[model samples]
Target: MSAALDQTGSAGHWSPVESWSRDELESYQLERLREQLGRLARSPGHYGDLFGRMGFEPEEIRELSDITALPFTHKADYVASVAAAPPHGRFVSVPMSEVRRIHFSSGTTAKPTPQFWTQRDLDRWADLYARTAHAQGVEPGDVFQCLFTYTWFVGGLGATLGYQRAGATCIPAGSQDTARQISTIFEYGTTVLCGTPSFIVHLGEEIEKRGLSPATSKVRAIMVGGEPGASVPATRKRIQDLWDARCYDFYGCLEFQPIAGECEAQSGPHIAEDFVCAEIVDPDTKAPVPDGTPGVLVVTHLDKQAGPLVRWWTGDIVVRDRSRCGCGRTHARLVGGVHGRADDMLIVRGVNVFPSAVEDVVRAIPGLGDEYQIVVDRSVRDDATGFLKGIRLRVEGSDPALPARLAEAIKQRLSIRAEIELLPPGSLERTTHKAKRLVRADD
Candidate 1:
């Protein structure tokens, strides 16, 4: 009944999918792609209509490269399809009666979008979650504390199933209630902590407020996702110091909950190449870029039942390294761990800036707290031209010199000057779930 045995199944232990040669892996991918295609064609969904409109026949895909023939599935396309078809949309691959769960995106930019999952889809999601946990060194005896939101978000489901797959006990510590979170760690001897990087940092601050250090907790490792912080050296070290635990980074999207994860080496997160195919391409030209080149992240789901995504363009900017990692997983790793987003780009005084870039600077400063917001102020606007007033940073802290120091650091790193305003230590609101990084302030 050990985790290793559980993963091995009765046949053997551990799946060697990552260890397969390039050709072998591609062959498997092609098989999965074909199976998904046939299912899509048979189902009454938008994908089948899309494939037909493009004159693409599933039989025509003789090789993996032939996937390029299919048209890309854009999120806007899904939004439109939902408006036209209603509810789950025609893109759903299963019968409407089979869907057991429905999750909504936070959708800061627009209204929340609906995603449906059948029992089969949930099962696959659990398997992927578990695979990541085991790959990241989650052991049989470890106790995992799940602190993500389970109300409408998909993250909690991923952590719960992953712990179950790894044969570890999971404490369902839902988001909110910081005091309860701190008590559970010591009371239950939680060995694994999983949540957003900001929340983890806030948890550390709360623990310290009670005259306790991170070292006093039994938790040994922290898995961070839903935001970019663990990849940044300063933030990673801060959280590690908070609880004296190892930090691991995970990358996933609302479209696909589990994409890649960092192994013990902590170099970068390895892509789930088996289930998903990732490509870095120019955000504007949509052309494939070199492995290490920074570009927009484009994902294609090779396996999925409820929502079959084909060449879905994710708006995030990133870099990938396919070189073999020291951890021995042959899957590609994400470099810089989601540097920024194409949509979140800010034009501040003729300089292009990202919220994450500002974050890198803020989290590195000593006196700053977790709750912070960036504002791109616009003095005047017209149809022809606009004036760049400046970018203002409102951080949670009361230190007298912290604002000047933070502004100087940002100017040095981004080559763009920023105005910092320090608020009371607990003046700004803290997020129990996702951290909001930017707010527009125009005057």
Candidate 2:
């Protein structure tokens, strides 16, 4: 049995709110929302003006559903607000003195969304992340190596603080030195490996190149976040087989850091209901979808102190299931982790292809290297629709017949023909930071 699961049956519970019923959770949320709205009402920021314009009295939210009546917050709005005001802008609810941490989105496309966190907010984040590590079975005396970047407006610092709070020794080795990261794992007996699924794969490839046996390694778990991979069946299975560890998926965004994640049961990632009120809604209409249906995840911060967002659209697609988990938590669990970002979907030949879905196919193939890139060329071949879209999947593989097989798998899974180009090992670039998936040939 897994060390975390065995401990979960006895001493693995995180907080009292985890056992609360929906009624109790909702009631608690309403009270907190009242408090949150009242704070925003008196604050000097975009949120205050937003609430005032809605004439939304804190006490007026008699039920949780009343939140829908308010305007939904989007990333574009934050970018514009911050661009006009600079730095945090009116989006910051707390004064400059109260804010201690500043985080920003990847800024890959548009302007980065700046996130402000007060000292108290950091503590709460630590608490939530502690629960995340504990959920995956990290206990006292265990060591966790954090391979994510540690500087700037990134998510790595939170995991570092979180594991320390959870009573585990944290090794802050941001993806720079692969050799050192591997040596630290065995030297420190690191029990938990926290990083993106792509980097984990890179580490596995590095291990094999060094002629080392991971079965003899001390690492026991892998907590994946920052990009989709942990829940991708093929991706997760590959990581599991490589390190022989329990892999857990974490779900959250720059606006809301580490809100939901998986437990030892590994059913799915459970959202912190006491802190975040989550809803899965249609990506287009923004209307609520029935449980177990995939939709854009809209979230509201119930306990955030710096910039408590309400009805913020997270762009990531997920399904919420309230089924009781064997781990004894009633918090809502994302059915299949995050499938893909609505914005990241690639339309090829009138067919939608998610990068993660493509990853599922790529990772399942044996002897395929850890790196892969998807490029969609609009100028390739066009029919009557004016878009003869072609998807080129560049993967690191030496097998001559691998391209044909991969093309067939991509065709079968995504229902679209892809031109697969297999390269020798290490042909594709690797990343210590966020792995770039789509390389647009149109540029």
Candidate 1 per-residue lDDT over residues 1-443, each given as its tens digit: 24454544222223566556667777888888888787787666787877778777788888876776776778888888878877666677777788887888887655677887888778777777776777767878999999888888889888898778777898888888999899889888999989998898888888888998878888898999988888877778888887889998888988887888887789888888888877788888877889888888888778777777888888888889988777666778897788778877877667777787788788789878877888755532232466444578889876798989998898899887777888888877778787878775653
Alpha-carbon shift of residue 383 in model 1 (angstroms): 12
Runs in model 1 deviating more than 4 A are 1-14, 107-111, 348-351, 379-390
List residue ranges in candidate 2 displaced over 4 A.
Answer: 1-11, 110-113, 348-351, 379-381, 387-390
lDDT of each: 0.80, 0.83
Task: Give a tens-digit lDDT track for model 2, residues 1-443.
Answer: 23344344344577666767777888998889878878888898887787788777777778888888888888888888988998767778877899998888878778777788999899889888988887777778988899988767567898899888877888888878899988888887888888888899888878888999775788888898888888888988988888998888987778898779899888889998888888889988889999988899988989799988888988998878997788888899997788888877777767866788888999888878878998866645575675646678889877898998888888888898888878888888888777888776765
Model 1 error, position 147 (Å) = 0.7
TM-score for each model:
0.92, 0.93
Best by lDDT: 2
RMSD of each: 2.9, 3.3
